[model samples]
Target: MQLTPTLLAEATRRGLLSTEQGQALWDFLAEQEREQQHDTPSFKAAHILYYLGGLIAIGAMTLFMTIGWEQFGGTGLLLISLVYGTAALLLTEYLFERKHLALPAGLTAVLAVVMVPLAVYGAQHAIGLWSDGDARHTAYRDFHYYIDWRWLVMEFATLAAGAVALWRYRLPFLVLPVAVTLWYMSMDLTPLLLGGDNLGFFSDLGKLISLWFGVAMTLLAFWVDLRSRHTKDFAFWLYIFGVLTFWGALSSMDSGSEWGKLAYCAINLLMIAIGAALSRRVFAVFGGLGIAGYLGHLSYTVFKDSLMFPLALTAIGLAVVAIGIYWQRHEAAIGRSLRRILPAPMRELVEQRRG
Candidate 1:
């Protein structure tokens, strides 16, 4: 009757067993496990039914999206998907105790994807992607002249809805959509400060503000993770890295001198290195992106006038890979250390099994 330290911690977290109830729960669970070694016919039948129901539900949703929903208006489709997804999630939570089913997350992610494309199409339509008469007679021309505040209101409403959903579900997948909405909002406000005539300044300011906000959010997420110890949500760290890299790219683009370029490259490399040293997965993934970017810069330089092999790229790649491997090994050691720190009840369970 062995209880792993991880299992004990999980039990404590779930309030399944208090300090006094730990030993009794362990004994009961062990006995239950022993008695359940031989599965009953009904148990097997129930499992089969559960899986079959999940499959059928997924298939039906897929068919509805492809056949019935695609023909609807963009707004209508989004609303339908939202309602159906919410209903499905509620039903699953009520029927089964599975709180974190993938279907709802999948549905929301798909809806976000659909929103982006539809929003882009709507923008194109308003901007006169296809206008037969005078260019001034196009939808784009009319849209700007008669710019409705309702469009801005709708965007803000959508952003608020997304924020609420993310907060309710605690899903990290919602971060991108939330960030996108924030960026759009920032862009909408840029004209107020930078002036509509200074398009370049407005664009630059918008990007800078968005990147700064992203960095701020990333730092906040890390702070939350530190308090909670939920390293599984690695996406927040990745988002931070992405925003920093983008900021670096923008800085490099604006740099005019050779030394300025070199400084930008050095700063970007330093940030990536620091980030990689902190997280092995991020290091492994973003190290590749950093290498590709450096190589592209090197290629551009070579084509312009300078002909030189990029030894720095090779060295940087090797360094990143080496650090990633070290972190992986270090993480394993940490796991072993944690196992040795098991509480008394869990340690007792382990001893019982050994006896």
Candidate 2:
């Protein structure tokens, strides 16, 4: 099926075409392949630089923002963010609509999305909606480091702006800000929902809320995945952050009894199975860590005095490795069988990815 130069030469040898024609066809196909690679996302030098530069810019604006910028005050930060966002959006329009560059356009759109929170923070402060007296609410930089109920306004604004940008640009990378904001909202909403002057931010109730929010986000990702599979991997970021939120909150909760810990292990095992079934590695990675942590706990406690523990652990590790080898060898058949066992709609979901 692959039209390679070797195959073309063989055809010419068999008198199917002249040497000139074979060379012409090969050159044409090579050019076509190159064009396709250029059009799509890849690990090429240009593409790598595009993303790397964009990430650094984004980090500088958000995560790496300095305390000195706090001197700008709310209104100043607001105006600066709007100006930067406008420039980024104008550039995005030029790149996508004029220059026809998708990667850089997406990156610029993401930059615009990142400005939403800063603008919102400024508006809140300038209008006296957010009090400057609160330390957590004093500066925009704390937005990345602290979780306060007051951040809800900025978080909601970011989500809205992110949604609008994604809808306008139709870029997969635009999902990043939305997913991250949702994750922050999950934590920030805790104190607000539980009710207090920020009393239950790290309470047991907050943890449960996080777990539930993660479940919702994961389900949303699944829905997005099923819909976007034919177009782009728009659901990828959502699945990543969703799993992170869920797994982190789940792992943080105390399981006082051995039975409780065993139940936790079982839940993680289910996550791994679900991940494998869906071909999404995010679930598998977190699940694997959880299982490893449980096993480590047992080794340190239940098997501490047993000399055979090390041998048992080694055997288990080797068995897992063997299973992986066997799975890789029979991947096609196994994948087909797994898909077959699912309900019709679920099978369709997996089949779309596999196909």
Q: Among all windows of ten consecutive residues in candidate 1, which has the lowest summed lDDT?
A: 140-149
- Which candidate number maximizes TM-score? 2
Model 2: per-residue Cα lDDT over 1-355, one tens digit each:
6677788889999999999989988889888778667656789999999989999999999999988987787799899999999999999999999998888899999999899898988888788776757555567788898878888888889889998998898988899999999999888887777776465436788888888889999999999988876777899899999898888888999988999999999999999988977889999999999999999899999888999999988998899899999999999899888778887767877877655
TM-score of each model, paired residue for residue:
0.49, 0.87
lDDT scores in order: 0.49, 0.87
Q: What clash count goes with each model?
A: 0, 0
Q: Please report the candidate that would top lDDT against the real structure.
A: 2
Residue clash pairs of candidate 1: none
Candidate 2, run of 10 with poorest lDDT: 194-203
lDDT string for model 1 (1-355, tens) is: 4686568867877998785577677778877665444221124665456446554554444323243333454445445555665565565344324544433453344344324323432444444453345433323223223222223444565576666655555545455555544444444455555555343223566566545654665565545444334323424533555555355435535557767656666755765654543442443444446546655776777444544355665687799799878878796575457547876554443333224
In terms of TM-score, how similar is model 1 to the real structure?
0.49
Q: How displaced is residue 306 in candidate 2, in Å?
A: 1.3
